[model samples]
Target: MFDDLISLCLTGSPPALPQDWWLRWSLAPATLLPLLGLLAWLLARRRRPLPLVGWALLALALASPLCRLAATLAAAHMVQLMLLLAGMGLLVLASPPRAHMPRPGPAAAVHGALLWLWHWPPLYAAVLGHAGLHVLALALLLGSAWWFWRAVLLAPPPWRGTALLALLATMAHTGLLGALLTFAGEPLYAAPGARAWGLEPLHDQQLAGLLMWVLGALGYLLAAVALALRWFAPGHPVRRATPAH
Candidate 1:
């Protein structure tokens, strides 16, 4: 019964993505609670707009054919991996620009979140099972983690400190979703060579859903940690002073 409802909602017309992870992720303030902390730190010092690595991460997440490569190991996976690494290489060199500086409250929060949403999730479940695509997604995320570690996480101190935790969440969320589908013996998404990889179709679908949660949560947490560290760290330049009578 519930399955019927899910199918209907997801396929009411070729589907338009279940829930908007990108939407909320973009708004850095509300979604990324710690963003203000970092902004304060950078702004207090009167530094040039500090670079924001999220944009680079966003781009790499999008550039791939699958955008997320949630398939059954394939050639496209390798290509996608190569491209992700390459993009990360470029991000390291080019450096992302900071938000258009800060602004008033509620309004600014909305704007920042919008910026974060551009980081695409690829929604690979739809087409990633070509065997070619599977290998690509895994490799890209794992491989890029290394290349991006320094440039993305390290470059931004606070952002760096919390990135690992957030990243793990992203991976776990999606993996969990996929796992659930597998356990239920239902295939939300299918890969041609799933059996070869020893994953039943239903199991493959479960993995995809799991991956969604994994990456989605991780991406979310990464932004969150970066923002949090910026917020709570002691002696932060942004700490407001008490109003004097």
Candidate 2:
């Protein structure tokens, strides 16, 4: 059991690990330590501390090594992606520095392009094969996702309509991509170790696609509604810039 746990923690490869694999005490120092440092710095500031909910979400997303094991299944991988997006969204929304968000149209286009490019077979393979590349992929995805959500949901009032359109566009594009993946006759990527988890490649791909299509698009639609509410609410106070820390 101990040997199996060690193997599971050491690599994203699979041998159908036991449930305890998620509870292992392993640390991804390269990922976790910097985040912890940031949390500490935020708390030490004399001003209002950062949001605890945001920090907690990020900590759970980055510090838990279970993501590695989860990647063995495509459906599980989608869940990991959703968790990272949620964490990053919370962190960005709740951060003290209020940078001006980018225009939603260009931001959405860039985000969609990145998603397609990264999910290409060669890139996904590289991510799985090299630990460093895997980290880089996650970083890029998190950053892009943060930018996308910020533009869609947090844009200033003047750009709210444009933001809504951008969100809708993202929903359409991503949903289309997901549909294609779901209906594809064969597995898109021949990822190693997928079979070790007893996953049927085609079905796994479909499941991943459905998650992206339904859940992802639903998230965008909800954000659009939230933005619309804020924009049209009666006598809403003009949102001030976030105070400097």
Which prediction has the highest lDDT against the true structure?
A: 2
- Count the clashes in each prediction: 40, 0
Q: Where does candidate 2 have its weakest 10-residue lDDT segment?
A: 1-10
User: Ten consecutive residues with minimal summed lDDT in candidate 1?
Assistant: 1-10
Supply candidate 1's per-residue lDDT for 151.
Answer: 28
| Model 1 whole-model lDDT (C-alpha atoms) | 0.37
lDDT of each: 0.37, 0.67
lDDT tens per residue, model 2, 102-170: 777777888888888767877876676676777667678877877877776677666678889998988
Candidate 2 segments exceeding 4 Å error: 1-20, 23-25, 41-51, 96-100, 191-198, 240-245
Model 1's TM-score against the true structure: 0.33
Q: Point to the candidate with the largest TM-score.
A: 2
